[model samples]
Target: MTQLPPRFEISRQDIARVVAVFYERIRGHPGLGPVFAAHVDDWPSHEAKVTDFWANAILHERSYDGNPVEVHRRAGNVRPGMFDTWLALFDHVLAREVTPQQAQAWSALAHRIGRTVRAGVVDQAKGPGGVPILR
Candidate 1:
């Protein structure tokens, strides 16, 4: 059995800090802001949910249970291309808010999630024979 890398010692406070900063940037971004605004009716609740998600993912807390892929698919406004902008903002905030080790560890997970979400969106948009449907 392959041993997993030792988890980074990030606290819930640290996760909350990063989530707060990251979402603040997302809410202000031209491309992402409107997309989020269209889907998210309650900012505080959404922020709390996101914080829980990050805390669970990074700190191994078992608090978050929602299916992120299904959430993004239901969002309808999120496209595959948006992951780039999201990750860029995420990387920026992660660098400023966390230690280098934390940033690296969190970024790897974030990128994997981003790619999965993007693929889910893309596959949903594609028809048989791998051709993308015109929106």
Candidate 2:
């Protein structure tokens, strides 16, 4: 009988690795670094949040519950084009470290998060003076 690969799993350690590499790239990204740097004071806390978020999103671990869209909106005017750049960076890191299926899942997750965040921001912006509720 032929052996097959085991079911894919998103471990906390694996998610940490991905988040680390992703942030490494994000830190160097010209478009996002300044914005991230200006706002995020605690790198470890931020990394932990991302790790939990991805683990929950991809692995159904339920390790994260905070509002992601609120987090993004707090960054202020995350121009539409930034999502593409963010996705590109995420894909690059994920591809370098994870399986194809894992990468695909992450890509889809990122798009969903981006859309959710964007929609929340846009909806909040529609209020009286075109400003988001959180920031």
Candidate 1, 1-135: lDDT as tens digits: 564433678888888888888888988999999999998888878888998888777766678889999988888777788888899899999999999988988899999999998888877877789796434
Off by over 4 Å in 1: 1-6, 127-130, 133-135
- The per-candidate count of clashes, in order, stands at 0, 0
In model 2, where do residues sit more than 4 Å from their true spots? 1-8, 124-135
Please provide TM-scores, in order, for all candidate models, with all chains considered together.
0.88, 0.80
Of candidate 2, the 10-residue stretch with the lowest lDDT total is 1-10
Model 2 Cα displacement at 49 (Å)? 1.0
lDDT of prediction 1 = 0.84
Clash pairs, model 2 backbone: none
When summed lDDT is taken over every stretch of 10 residues in candidate 1, the lowest stretch is: 1-10
Cα error, residue 94 of model 2, in Å, equals 1.1
